[model samples]
Structure formats: C-alpha cells, structure tokens
Target chain A: MKLISVKLSPLNSKKNKLKFSVTVTLKKDVLDPQGKVVQNTLKNLGMHDLKNIRQGKFFEIEINEKDEKLAQEKVNEMCKKLLVNLIIEDYKINILK
Target chain B: MRSSVIVFPGSNCDRDIAVALQKMQFKNKMVWHKETALPKSDLIIIPGGFSYGDYLRSGAIAGKSLIIEEVVKAAKFGSLVLGICNGFQILTETGLLKGTLLRNKNLKFINKDVHIKVINNTTKFTSKYKLNQILKLNIAHNEGNFFTDNDHLKELNNDNLIAFKYSDEKGNTSNLSNPNGALDNIAGIFNDKKNILGMMPHPERMVDNLISNKDGVNLFSSLLG
Candidate 1:
C-alpha cells in the first residue's frame, strides 16, 4: 500500500493542471458608458453610497501545462493576442491553482 | 478594379457592398471569413455587420477570423482596404487602424442620414470629391464614438490623415454636428500610408439614386480612377 501511494503521488504531480483567471477592464482614460448607466440605475434604486462603477469582463482559463511559469506565460500571450484589447482595456491575470 | 468584400458570419451588408461595387464596374467577389486566401484584388472591403453577433465586443471575434490574416497581408502589400461601420470596428480590433469605437455617448443606437465633410481628398478613396465637400451619408451604429490616446490624436491631425468629419450642411464641424461623439467630429480616417480607410458611415447604402441619393457614387468613382 505504501508503494502504490508513492506511485500515484508522482502521477498526480505530473498531470497537475494550472488554472488562471483574467480580469479585463477599460483603461482609466476610456469611458465606460454601460457602467455609467448601471451606476445611474443603482443610484435611482436607492444605492446612494455608490460613488462609481466600472464595467469589465472576466475570463477563467485552465491550461494543460504542468509548469506554473509556462502556464502563466501562455495565459499572458492569450490575453495580449485575443482575450483583451490592449488599446482600450487592461487585464490582470491571477493564478487559481 | 478588382475588389473583394470579406463576408463573415452574421454579416448583413455583404450583398449591399457587392451590389455597389458591381454598379461601379468593379469585378467584386464575396470572400468567406473561413477562407485562408483572398482573391487577387486591388481593393478589399470589410463590410458592415454584427460579426459573431457582436460577442466579446463588436468585431472582436471577426477581427481574429481566418480571412483577416489574408486581409492584413494584402494591406501590407499596399492594397486599398476599406472598413465601414462594424467593419470599422474590426479594423481597430485588428490593429490595422489606430483607435477604437466606443459606445455612443448617449448610449443609444443612432441610425440616420448625417452630413460628413471631406477632410482630405488626395487619397484614391476620396480623389473624386472636392476638398471640404459635405456629403450626406447613412450612419447606423451603436458604437461609433471614436476614441484614441492624445498622442495618436495629435499624429492624426499633424499628418492630415483625417478623411471625413461630421459637419452641418454648410460644412461647420461643431459639437452640435457631432452625431456619435467621435473625437474631433471624425467620421472617417486614413492610415499614414493613405491605403487604408475605416469609417462608420455606410457609403454603399447611398450609391443608388432610386433607393437613396448619389452622394456615395464619388467614393466608388474615385477608387475606380
């Protein structure tokens, strides 16, 4: 039983998948009209303490790589190439596991 | 002139641009988005439509389509590329043109005939129009407000790359004349090389005198010349 458990532990580490979450939001200078409308509606509904609201998109990606550094690099490439528009938006990537 | 119009999924104005191109005596072909190669053409048009149903922002999916690679290659080879309306959105997404089209300031989809003044008529796309000519064109869009960084705005102005500006009938480009709150009343702009143009108005919609006026005819004619 000790021998089998040791074998399984190596396999589990070898097949470990990396999970990442990316948050994309409009740049500081860019105007988010949709967020403004939502904030106005919330204020009208009695949420008077809300000062501002900025809308954005969130994406969760699971990469099939075992190396954490490589998985993070891949996610950054995906964000730069497709997931986020660098011109008008900024993105932050966080490792989930 | 040999022309190609890229047709992506959910493209509604593919046939409209094809008709206008054919009327202008252009040998036009409708290229599907999944195709990898573009037909041999001098002008490549990305027509207006809600590509991928405007998912993940307008034109975001369509900008990364298979055919866009070929379009980018062709543009690099100095082919004239025109992107109208949602096509304009795709161009910005692909980074072929600077700036992005944000949601309308009023947060409403505006559809109406607006006046646009020809800002620069030296390019092949606007050679037929007189300088500062006011043209009535159809604009229907929810995200037509053009925005860019301050540095790029200065570059566009300094290089005289502005193609058209929203203006009054008398050609007054003022805040009141601005339709969608575009920066500096900009309706259309050219790349630094003057080979690429992206605009929000639908010139193809105004080419027919029977259905609409002939204000857009000069644009096609200029290309033919």
Candidate 2:
C-alpha cells in the first residue's frame, strides 16, 4: 500500500496562506484487510522481511487563514468534522506555509 | 401508519423497501437525500445499496449529506429509524448507532441467507418475534463485520441493546453461525432508546411470498401496528 508521504516545511511567513495537510489512518485495533492482502502479495514476491501493512488516506487541504495558530485550529476542526471517523480512525494535521 | 425512505444517489434498495412498506399498508413516501426536511412520518428508513458508490468508506459520504441532519432530528424525537445493509453502515457513520463495519474477516463479499436470533424483542423493530426466535434473512455485503471496543460491547450487553444475533436454525449462537465475523455474533443493534435499528440483513427482500417467503413481513407489521 502506498502511504501518503508529506514533507512539512516550517511556517515562515504570517501573510502567506498555509497549506494544511491531514493524514487519516485507521485505528491500530481496526482490521485492515486490503493492507494485509498487499502485504501478502509482497511477501509472495520475495520481500520476506515484510511483517505487516496498514492502509489509510491523506488529504492536502487549503485554508484561507493567514495566522498560523488560526489555520491550525481550522484544520483541526476539518479533521474532526469530516476528514476522519474517530471510531475506527485517527488523524494527524500538519500546517505548512 | 406513515413512513418515509430516504433515497440517496446510487441507492438501489429504496424502491424495494418502499414496496415493502406499501404492502404492509403504510403510507410511504420516497424522500430524496437533498431535501432539507422530511415529510411528517411515523418511521424513516435508510434502505440498502451503495450510496455515493461507497467512496471514502461505505456510507461516510452520505452520512454528511444535509438530509442526514433531518434524519438525526427525526431519530431523536422518537420517530423510528430502520437501517438495512448500507443503511446500517450509514447509521453507524452518523453516530445514530454505535460501532463500525469492517471488511469481512474472510475478505470476500458475502451474499446468502442466514438465520438470526431475535435478541431483544422488546425493541420496536423486533417486538413481533419472541426472544431468541430464529429468523432466516438474507445478508449481502462486503463490509459487514461488526466491531466495537470492549467497553462498548460490555455496555451494549448490559443495556440489552443488541437487537439480533446470528444463530443456527435451532437458535444456537456460535462462532460458526457468524457469517461476517461480527462481535458476539451481533447481526443487528439498537440505540440506547431503542428507536433506531441498524442491521446488515435485507428484511425488505424477504417481505414477499412470491420471492421466496414472507419471513420479514412481521418486522414491517410490527412497525405498522
């Protein structure tokens, strides 16, 4: 499974609109069969060291807010509102200017 | 009695459930998902089928639709809510019901008839059946594996909110009887007030005798009364 790789740059300016990146992943306890299938496939292909794989989604959300703290707050709300279901998933938020 | 079935885009089973309601003598309306308000009705049903093509997790997209706002309001004010198949997924996603449906442990879409025991007949949905009665119902879905944290499971058990449990022909529950690897053989559940029901089985498909049997007629009849 291709996990969403995000490289965060430190917030350097106050006027620039920040690009809020959010990663949603299933909770550790939830079973991820698709990831397991990919793991098994990789193991069959001779990557024997593969122990496991867990699949999840990622989103790069654009926010209009200029203040770093306010932008982070908005992204946090977005994650709680729709980007994730806390029942079986966890989310991480990253803000980059 | 009056009833309404919410019709979301890509929902294929709304008509089936509408037919079931009509046959049971309920004045039923097909409410589109875009509507901001529901027609005054005694019951609102979320029927089976792939809403929003099951994207971004099954029922996740539809759960956020504006129509769900009305659904949540109706459910809270004592209007009965019934969710079948994908509807069950939506109910869970909406937090109107608890738990999540993980992909089947066997990693395959299951479609077949199975026996479910009525666990809580006191609820509005299962009142017609005696407790522990085995009823043959059809379930068809890829993600029907019912999962909840241990604390939630304990609370559900303590509250007697588990509406249905997978069982054999003789009403015996065991690991072998669970088709979807659901926790505690749970096939259906009710919210705290017992006004909401979420189950993977297609009771609408079983409401007609010509189709095979009217095994699901009692469920509708119970609600109609």
Candidate 3:
C-alpha cells in the first residue's frame, strides 16, 4: 500500500542552478547477457584483452539548488524513487557543480 | 464473475483477455489507463503488451499512469488483481508485487509456449487445478526474468505466495526447464495478502479450443469458480 515517494529539492534562495549526474547500472548479481554477448563478439573480433563488459544506463540531471548537501540528498532520493530500479540496478550520483 | 481489465495505450492483450473472460461468461469491463476509478469487480486484470512502448524500463511509464492509483486502492481493499507479462512488470513497478522482472538471460525476445508447473494451487488463481499440474501457456517478452534479493526471497517462501514455476512436460522444475532464466525459475507470484497475482505467461492466449490446446482454460475457470 506504499505510494511512490516524490522528493523535492529545496529551492536555491539565491536562484542558482545545481549540476549533478546520475548513472544507473545493473547490479553485479543480476546477469547482463547483452553485455556478455558484446564481450564475446569483441573477443571473436580479436579483442582478447577485455575481461568483462556490463551494459547500463546513465543520466545527467540538473536542478535549481544552492546548497550542495540538499542537492545531493534530493538527487539521491530521485535515483531511489524513480531514476533507478534498486531491485536490479545500482545507481551512482555525482555532484558535478 | 465481475472483472475489469485495465488497458493502457500500448496494451495489445487486453482484448484477448477480454474475449477469454467473456468465453467464461465473465462480466468483463475494459477500463482505460486515463480512467480514474475502477468499476466494481471480483477481479482486476492488467493484460500484457508494451505499455508506453516499454520506454524508461518495461513497465515504469505505465506504472505511474493515472489508472494505477485506482488499482492500488482496489488492491488494498482486497480485490483480486492479476497481471500478465507486461502487466506483471507494471505490478512490480507500482510496488503492488515484490521484486522486478529483469531482461532475459539470453537477451532475446522469446516467443513460444512453455510449460509452467503449478507450485501452489490453493489460491483463487489456481484452485481449479491440482497442485504441481503442468500447463502450457504463451510467454512472449524480452524481460521476463524475475529478480529479488535473498532476504526478500526468504520472506516470499515464508509467505507461500509463489504460484508458478517454469517447468517441463512432466512438471520437473530446474535450470534447463526455465524459459526466461527467472530467479528460482519463478513464472508467477502472488502478493503477500494472496490477492494480487503477477506472471509472465499469457494464459488467455491458450484458453481457446480453436487453438487446439486448451490447457489455460482452467485458470479462468478457477477465477470464475
């Protein structure tokens, strides 16, 4: 019965835009066959140095916030609630600016 | 039996299920994704098909659609909810069902009939069949692999909510019998309350005798029972 949580970041009191990047990838436990096929194809094409190749999705998002801490918390919440499926994917949030 | 099938824009299996339900003499109503409230029903089925073109994840977009609000409310009130294939994905995305459906292990769009063992037939969905009965059902999708963490799996086993597993003709369940490489070879699972059901197979597609195989007829019969 739990509803999807919508997390809103605090507005910048000084009207400054914040920059952050979010990367979503399949978890290590989950099998990424697409990535594996790519690796095999590369190996067949004479790329033997590659050990593994995992496919994932990445997103670069920006929001209006002044405080770095608030921005971090907000974007992290976004990844958990919507941007990523924690069941199968791992996400990383990088605060660029 | 009174039943409602929620159809999103990309849902192509709604009509098939509607016809299947009608053949069972069910009072079937097709509810749109834009609709607000669900009609009174004994059961609610979210039929398969790529909702919102399966973008941003298979069922993510359709899960946030307006009609799901009513689905959550109705499920909370104990109305039986069954989601098939893409519908199953939507259930997981909406948090109505636990775990998620990941991409198939082979990363291929598998389309064919597979045998599914009836793990537990005591519920409304499988009561018409004996426990461990094997039924043939259509499975078509690229992301039908069920995934869940260890802790969640323990809880699921404790709750006895698991409903079906991909199996062979003799009802042997193992790694080789698995069609989608689903975790634990799970093809269907029920909610903790045993009111919501989600599975990757399309039983409606096999319910008709015109198709020669009528193995799926018992499922709808159980619901109407």
Candidate 4:
C-alpha cells in the first residue's frame, strides 16, 4: 500500500475578509415618486441639463470567505434572499476587495 | 378563535391589535419577532408600525425576521394571516402577497381617515361585510401606494383577488377617492388562496366606538364566524 502525504498552505489557515457593495434600484416599470421629487428639486437648483435622477440604496457588506468567486456568489444569494425585493427592485453586486 | 400578533422592535401597533383582538372575544397572544416558533394560532395579525425604523425600505428588514418564517409557514398551511399598513408592506416584502407599496405620490406621510370599499366579501376576512360595502378606516403611512406589474395586475383582476379599493362613501372607486396613488385605487388584496390579506388601512384602530367608529368590528366578527 502506498502512503500519500497532504500539505496545508498558510493561505488556507488565514481567513480572508472580502468586501462587496450592493446597489438596489427600483425597476424601470415601477414608478419612483421619491426619485421624481428629488429630480425635480435638483432641476430647480440650477441643474436644468439633468435629464433625470433615480434614487437607490447602497450596502457595503464584508464576508469571511477564501475564494473570491464564492464570496460573490454568497453576496448574490444575500441580495436575492433579503437585500432585494424582486417584485419592484433590482440589484447589482460588485466586489470592493 | 385564537390569534397571534407579531411584535417587532418598532411595532408600536402591537398592543393596539392585541387589545382589538381581545375585545373581539378572541384569545390573543403577543409574539416577539425573535421567537422562531408560533403558538398554534388560527389567525396571525401583523399590525401596522415602522418595523426596523423602515430600514433599507419599508418592511424590508422586518420581512426577514425569525418569526416571519413561521408566519409564512402558517399562512401556507391555510391559516388566516392579516397584514395592516406596515404589516402589508412586510407581507409584500416576504412575497406572501405580490406587489409592493411605493411612497405616496405626493411624497407625504398621510395620517387620516380613508374610505375603502370591500370589493369581495366572500373571503374568511370579509365574510361579514356586504359586497361593495364602504368602510371608513384610518390610514397612516408614507408608503401606502400599492403597485404591481401589469401581468400580476391582470391576474389579480382575473382571479378577483382584490379585497378592497379606495372608494367614496357611495362605494364609487375613482382616482379622486384614492388617498394614495395606489394602482387601480387598490387598498388591499388577498393571496391566491384568499387566506392571506394585506391592507394599508388600520382596521384595529377603528374598532373602539368611544375612540373611533365600529366599522372595523365586522372584520373581527367575520373571522369569529
């Protein structure tokens, strides 16, 4: 019988904290009355060239994960499960670190 | 009938709903949001309040509370679930009911009495009211405008899932009568099974005759029957 030896790397022991940012916005079809009010207010404040301004929410989340891809996947799951309301909102996730 | 009222961190209406339930002769219990298990309840009421201070979005955070999972399970099992005001937002956020409550068109936190017509009185929640009956109820919220995609709107209309509509005293629904810019003047709706109802109006606030009118009594009475 042949014996095999396994080696563990320092990277495996060290926990890597990944940072991600999630931006949530209402869907195009859904009306954004709050955004509309903001746009109007901005337009009145000497920003006539502005076509429109839609408001959205942003979240910075830090997760302890080793793989970048896995971290992103987990963030996406979080967005779908709690961060986003699919009925009227859409979300985009980005890796910050 | 036994009932349970969910109390979240910012759920100021918890006691109000509990009082209303007890006044209606139904044994009621106040369940905190952190509790994972529900006490075998025939009716679960998610009362109106700014849960989690309306963090992220109205009802967004509270929808993910530990107790909400059990509420969903109970609702799926054909137990009656009623969500009022912010509770309606929570229900929508949980996807128990379709659509979302957007900010008022005027971007104002409206707090006043509004008239809502009972469009369908056959459901367990509205059986005591007459079809097309008009009820004046108190509504207090910044995000009360109900919105849904066209497809879902069509389905709601086709299935007659709409439970109430903002209407005048004469039971005429129109844009003028709508306190908020809710699509089709909708004030409330039911899940496909008709066991879950989400409405923006505060029926519990209107139960006491000395404080407010007793128009909301039939709602509790209907559940008793």
Report per-candidate TM-score of chain A alone.
0.85, 0.79, 0.80, 0.83
Off by over 4 Å in 3: A1-15
Error of 3 at B147 (Å): 1.4
Q: Candidate 3, after superposition: displacement of residue B39 in Å?
A: 1.3
Candidate order by lDDT, highest to lowest?
A: 1, 4, 3, 2
Q: What C-alpha lDDT, on a 0 to 100 scale, does residue A57 get in candidate 3?
A: 88
Chain A TM-score of candidate 1 vs. true chain A: 0.85
Residue A49 of model 2: what lDDT? 92
Q: What is the docking quality class of candidate 2?
A: acceptable
Query: Who is ahead in lDDT, 1 or 4?
Result: 1
Interface RMSD of each: 1.0, 1.3, 1.0, 1.1
Q: How much of the real interface does each model capture, measured as fnat? A: 0.57, 0.50, 0.64, 0.86
- Name the regions of candidate 4 deviating beyond 4 angstroms: A1-15
Better of 1 and 2 by DockQ: 1
Point out where model 2 deviates above 4 Å: A1-15
- What is the per-residue lDDT of model 2 for residues A21-53, given as tens digits with 9 covering 90 to 100? 888878898888789888999999999999888
Give the TM-score of chain B in candidate 2.
0.98
> What lDDT does candidate 1 reach at residue B182?
96
Please provide, for model 1 over B37-63, each residue's C-alpha lDDT reduced to its tens digit, 9 standing for 90 to 100: 999999999999899999988999999
Which 10 residues in a row give candidate 1 chain B its minimum summed lDDT?
B5-14
lDDT of 2 by residue, B123-182 (tens): 777778888888899999999999998988998999999988999999889999999889
Tens digit of lDDT per residue, candidate 4, span A1-97? Answer: 1222223434544457788999999888888887998888999898999997778999999988869899999999999988888888888988884
